[model samples]
Target: MTPSNTHTRNTHLSKESEQSQINKAQARYRREASDAAAAFMQFWRKTKEESTVPTKYKELMQLAIVLVQHCRPCINLHTQICVQVGCTRAEILDAANIALAMGGGPVFEYIGYLMQALDEFDPPKEAT
Candidate 1:
């Protein structure tokens, strides 16, 4: 084959190799993220189980932390846990307020997510 043809073939192979490498990196990232999520869940469960604080209180504190961190998923999970553990709406609001105070203006944007979580997990009842 001519040199030009050889160069074209090599360029194609290089591009394919680059794509394969990118795919491998993406797969690795996904695997690591899944593993980290599993580990974190295990640690979270163990801590809640063993803590001297009540589960509801722990969930409340977690809500405050997630609010400050602006983690929507954590807010959803912990808000649901709070409701499951018998936390009142008042208690949830209080935790959110404390987080907002501590987190300042940035926290305001995420508080909407918190409210949406509350609505999703513990919607108000209609009057009889």
Candidate 2:
């Protein structure tokens, strides 16, 4: 296993750029399987859009799960979106800790990616 500090995101791309790639891939998939992709995205919206769940908490949960999954594009997209929806640094880190508890050492390395994402996305507002 790599050291805990190792980050696996593509070295040259910004987080937004990573998200762009994911979007492009999604577009391609949608074109390739238009019906299935649309249905899946509809389900995606049903789960991810909104309801009784607050956006901040929902995104925190997503961040934790994605961190454990070690999907760099997901981490990049969700981290920025987490900040945009007003997740505090502490809240984000706490969610990361939950992932760490389940994901162990491999997840620890991925937290390095989360930290950078938080830093980049976290604006200069007051953080909890």
Candidate 3:
């Protein structure tokens, strides 16, 4: 009796372990999230390094806004990067407004999604 009970417990545990492994394999990669984050990082690095542009930061912010409006994950990643590089909330909102003007109602709908993501990943408060 004791041996049978122990065998059943081990079998149950083994099945759970196998299921978890299968789930992980099934959910691996997630290309959209990975790709968007990579693209945002690459663009951010390039935009920051170039020296010829007039109002470089603003230009970068404008581009970031367009990227964000098109891609929600890109918006979250780039917005966080922008905040790291001294972008203010007002500036971000302004860039988003510019996107709204260019992309219209569909763009406006995405703003709420982008804002939700930004709020989720808000930068830490700087010391005064």
Candidate 4:
């Protein structure tokens, strides 16, 4: 084969190898993400089931911690769970206020996001 043809073939092979590596990395990332989600779900269920604390209080505490940590997804999840566990809006708000006091300014900013999640998951009742 001509020298130019050999170089072109080598370049093409290198590109294919790079693409293969990228595909492998993406697959690994997806698998890790799935596994992490599954593990988290298992841990969440076990914690709720085994704890002596009532589920509502646990969810409230989780919401408070997530608010302080500024984890929007956790905030949403725990808020939804809090509602499902029969926690009143007032209770949730009180927990949020405590979080704000503990976390100060950063947690205060996230309160709006928490409210948005609450509205999405457990909107207020309309006036009769």
Candidate 5:
């Protein structure tokens, strides 16, 4: 099998490998990519926290979608937090759709990753 196929098949082979991917990503964010991520996040946080945007949560969520579409790592992190804080899934996704609506095909590809992050950070719970 090709390397891509091998990795895809191995992904289901064990939980360790799945976890390793997550760990690797987190480590990269904290190490090699931290400085840039930190600066980006700081600016994002300041904008959302200090600004008087009419609909801050909604606006931020939309911004997150656009940033994720643009592959901005730090914005993705804050976007996840915004979702947890109060932004609805629909609102977040609408933002993503806006990106596709304006940006066309290339921007659409990132929707899955954006949705995946949204799911990971804001998973649905069983109603009890």
Candidate 6:
């Protein structure tokens, strides 16, 4: 079976794997095509990791952009990053709503994926 198929199949069994798919794919590509992958990763670091904007805001903007583009993996990746950078659910939804306003119905439909990803990566914290 294809790797993507395996990722989908394993989703119910391993949310951890789901979150790592992008990292795994990047590792495979770097191993298989070292020069090209290195260049792309260098570019990724410059744009994503070194942004003048705060990482939290950059991650939120990325989530909004990917939601509009209908990229499920990117949405999941950025959602996880946003939470890691300390975004609350309200902030995540606020970023997501920008996509809805810009892309309208299609984006509205896909917001479900954002919701699912949010739940997967950052479920609500239980109150003490």
Best by TM-score: 2
lDDT of 2 by residue, 3-102 (tens): 4434444443555576677789989999999999999889987887777988778999999999999998788779888888887787888899999999
Against the true structure, candidate 5 reaches a TM-score of 0.52
Give each model a TM-score: 0.65, 0.79, 0.52, 0.65, 0.52, 0.73
Q: Rank the candidates by TM-score, best first.
A: 2, 6, 1, 4, 5, 3
Query: Candidate 6: where is the Cα deviation over 4 Å?
Result: 1-11, 14-26, 123-128
- Candidate 1 lDDT over 53-74, as tens digits, reads 8787888999999999998667
The TM-score obtained by model 3 is: 0.52
What clash pairs does model 1 have? Answer: none
Evaluate residue 48 in candidate 3 and report its C-alpha lDDT on the 0 to 100 scale: 66
Q: In model 1, which runs have C-alpha deviations exceeding 4 angstroms?
A: 1-39, 123-128
Superposed Cα deviation of residue 76, candidate 5 (Å) = 4.0
lDDT of each: 0.81, 0.82, 0.64, 0.81, 0.62, 0.82
> Which pairs in model 3 have colliding backbones?
none
Candidate 2, RMSD to the unseen true structure: 5.3
lDDT of 4 at 53: 92
- Per-model tally of clashing residue pairs: 0, 0, 0, 0, 0, 0
- lDDT tens per residue, model 4, 1-128: 99998986896577468657766886787687988767876887798973689887988898999999998657867888888878878889999999999999999999987886677677333312
Q: Cα miss at 37, model 3 (Å)?
A: 13
**What tens digits encode model 3's per-residue C-alpha lDDT throughout 23-123?**
57635643547777677768867866747664437544654566545865456556766676666566666677877877888888778755754575574
Q: How would you encode candidate 5's per-residue C-alpha lDDT over 1-128 as one tens digit per residue?
A: 89987875674354346556766897788787888878887986666563456454655556655654576443455556655556666666666677777778777666655665676567233212
